[model samples]
Target chain A: MPDAPLISVRELSKQFRTFKRREGVWGAIQNLVKRDYRTVQAVDRVTFEIQRGDMVGYIGPNGAGKSTTIKMLTGILVPTGGEIHSNGYVPWKQRRQYVKTIGVVFGQRTQLWWDIAVIESFKLLRKIYDVPQRDYDERMELFNAVLKLNDYLHTPVRKLSLGERMRCDLAAALLHNPPILFLDEPTIGLDVVAKDHIRQFLKEINQRYRTTVLLTTHDLDDIEELCKRIMIIDHGRLLYDGPLALLKQKLLRTKQVKFVVKDSEQAARIAVLEKDGRKIEAVDHLTYRIVFDRAEVSTAELLRQILAEVEVRDLLIEDEPIEEIVKRIYAGEALKEVSA
Target chain B: MGPGVRKHVELLVAYAVQFIKVRLAYRADFLISTGASMLATAFAFGFLVVLFQKVPQLAGWKFEEVLFLYGFSLIPFGLFNVVSLNLYNFGNDFIIEGKFDRVLLRPVASLYQVIFEVFRIESLHEVVVGLLGVWLAASRLKLAWGPLEFVLLFFFALCGAVIYVAIFLMLTCVSFWVEDRVGVHPPVWNLIAFGRYPLSIYSGFVQFLLSWIIPFGFATYYPSVRLLGRPEFRVYAWLVPVVAATFLTMAIALWNRGVREYSSTGS
Candidate 1:
């Protein structure tokens, strides 16, 4: 049991039935007597397991069932089908006991009292979660050291800036030392510096306390910077769940290397020296760009051959942008689903 | 009590303390609102005074008796206002705006959290107003005052408050099934006005509706009658506790059903 996954979900699904309304006042009147309803499958048979110490990024477009999945896992929304077992309890059934082991933060909403000082909210939360006084003091010291919350600890939540409030909110969630942390866009609507500060705090908590963090974010940098494993969900279905490096490699096989040469004739010579799924193109007479599968031809070998043939002035190597692959996923282009 | 119950009680007290602290932050706003409510209570008492001038008694009940009933009713009504008035906004603020998600996320009972999150200290003035009315009426009527009578009066007040809370709690649970923000509470809440005067003043059907259906009679009129030593209403007076318990049980059942609905549909 100790080796069991901290969170396990099997064939989970949620369907919402909404009253469909027609356009204009006439439709509103007709809707009183007779109603039209539509059912939307918000989450469909998503199956995944999260280990105790893993920081996993859950990414999807808006309304792509990311929140729905998170809600089910957090025991906020009961699934219409399937079963979920987290921390040895069925999430929705034993919600009170299950929630004791998990902490959640929604970026757009605050759990703090708006008019109270930040420290008072923390004190109240300490009592609500029944955290030991010694643990509370220790966590406060740690959060203050890492998050620098002492700067705005006495400020009312309404008076604090977005970054300051977010820091306090993060500290509030960790006051109980919950084993699992669920963050819904925890760094949304913040400047680069603020976002980096939160990411650093999250990384510190995950490493220092071994807290399992499941983060859902629209910000791809959150995934690239924090997550070793990323899950791609689109239109209620989970398309991919595996290592980030494997996803980048499997979806876009070719790595592009740009070379700017002193001689113009070498550009033409390089374009025709293509074989397999490798090709070289001339941006102009003096520059050549080589596109080759990294698995088939290593970047160092390709660069060595090109350098030996021509006196290269400058060169740049770039992997396929994750944005390109994500956009393709959003556009309904199918990639063979990857499971971890 | 068991440790589990003690822990929840401690949490409830903590929630109440935080709520009162927040309310006290706006001292001027609290004073103005409390003053306004007291003024409204004064107007209600004034209307009764003006009515007594036109008629010596209402439906064979003297002005002193009616005043006592009105005062007694406010004791429980005020208690309900102080504790559970937020139930009136359960649908609009909690459900429609999706704030209930926060309530459910915590490691406590959702209903307990909802009940204590806000305290209407401003409405405490209504209970003061009720005490003043009772004092003034008892002096005028020269009623026999004893330890048993005072204890029974206190007991009735507690029962009245529970009944009112149960009634509103049941109405509030309707929001879980029907997503309307306005909900079905207002019309039912306005019906508390019937219990202010003597039930004899209303027709037979209104009397039945108040006695058996909503049971506002057990909260106010019957208790007032028993306090006055009316042999006719003696049986009804003892039924107050039973009525209160039955309604509270039903309200809690409805609340559990509503919570189940909320978890399943997430509305």
Candidate 2:
């Protein structure tokens, strides 16, 4: 009925068994005879579905299994349990064929040959993927225009800067025209201008190609600019999966309203309006702050009442920062805060 | 060839070309490595010559026969180094640095991709030196050559190379099980040392171990004995291809199992 989502993962899990060695020389000697191992559940029964042409952000704290999930989806790691069907193929089972349908960029590493020119690397990839000559040229032209890769096309990969290397990697990943793209911190160590260039290029590519993009990044700006759907995982479990706007509204309910009143009379009038769970705090003689739950009182109603009774000089409204909301979510407090 | 096979071959050629270009960028390093390999081969040849001067024969084998065995052994070992040296870097470059993910992410068989990623073209000089040594020995021995013998020699040399490659792959696959122990090239070097001389010189148990257990003897000693028309060793000379194929299959199986067990490094 839903056209079979492009990426369907159900109850996926991965467990890693790591040895716990003793600290001292005596303990090490004992370990030679008998070793102890501890099994860590890196990913635990996490489930989500991504429709075609959707751009989703996968975020979690460090060691929260974000990269582990990406690894399994890209067929680089096999899952310990559960099922993942990405573009009609089981990722780890049908790796060679499945990888042809998806493009992956790992920011920490370069896929290009370290000693070869950027163009030679692309040519090798074309042969490896068996992309036709015409399609390869077309993609190269498009990438050159968008990423401006021509400047460093003949330069060896090891000679390029971090931003230039990342740009080339992104272009290389998309040359095959895969239906899905997985970017793991594609802008990890980039400057402001470089970050903007990458973010814009990604936005354009998703729009023009209708590529389903699943991004894992610590940069909230990357998520805010590109991903409409957000999935947050913590402790190897999926904590939340929904629209970004809904997450912001659900987890962050309080809105701070700042009012600069013309006189003390106007400020006194604003104090009377602060009843029924609304909070009012004074900044200076003329400036006042009002904190209110959006669900309890509409900002427009409060503003209307204030404007009618007091002479306001200036006003500003601020919502909670997404960083703070995410922090709370990772802290295991968002659910309780939402219910209360 | 079918388009699929042609494409893979073309990819391998492209990788070779790129690697050559990279090597050329470091012209001094390239020259130094080639010179080092040449010197090493020359020294080994010198060692054999000096030993033969002291004694007319080693065990039951003559000087030319021993030289032929040593020369034959170098052909496969050199080829193995040229083609599969990257497999030796599995621990440091691939596992520790997490570069193996690049191999897995490609839309090709991981082993096939790695096999062709880098070509050690400097080792080709070893093959040249080996052919020269074999020609000199054969001319001195006045050996009778026939068409079937030539064919057997060709296949035996190929099977020998496959055995070396298989052994290297299997040894490197140990990295999948244990961390901090990927330097398998030294052990492989020691194993190849056993093949540079006739197995007849060793004790019976050592010969048995090399012939059956590890099969380095199949690559050199048995092939030399067959080429020389030695009667006793001729019976088992045909086992060269069999041993190569079996060991190669087992090595590939072990490598695939290692891939399945590969957890990858870091987050």
Model 1, B1-267: lDDT tens per residue? Answer: 497798888887877787788778888998899889989999999999999999998888889988998998899999889988669889988898788888888998888888888889778788888978888888898988899999998899999999999999998998897766546777888999899989998999999999999999999999989887655578898899999999999999999899989987888
TM-score of each: 0.90, 0.90
Candidate 2, B1-267: lDDT as tens digits:
497788888888888999999999999999999999899999999999999899998888889988988888888878888987778887778877788888899988888887888889998887888878887888899989889877887788888889988888898888776654337568656878998897877899988889888889988778888987767678778788899999999999999888888843332
Model 1, position A271: C-alpha lDDT score:
51
Query: Global lDDT of each model?
Result: 0.87, 0.87
lDDT of 2 at A55: 94
- Best-matching candidate per DockQ: 1
Model 1 CA lDDT for position A273 = 51
TM-score, B chain alone, candidates in order: 0.96, 0.95
lDDT tens readout by residue for model 2, A60-166: 99999999999999999889899999999998889999999999999999989999999999999998888999999999998998899999999999999999999
Model 1 chain A: weakest 10-residue lDDT segment is A264-273
Superposed model 2: Cα runs more than 4 Å off:
A22-33, A253-316, A336-340, B263-267
State, as a TM-score between 0 and 1, how close model 1 is to the true structure. 0.90
DockQ for each numbered candidate: 0.60, 0.53
Quote model 2's TM-score.
Answer: 0.90
What is residue A218's positional error in candidate 2, in angstroms? 0.8
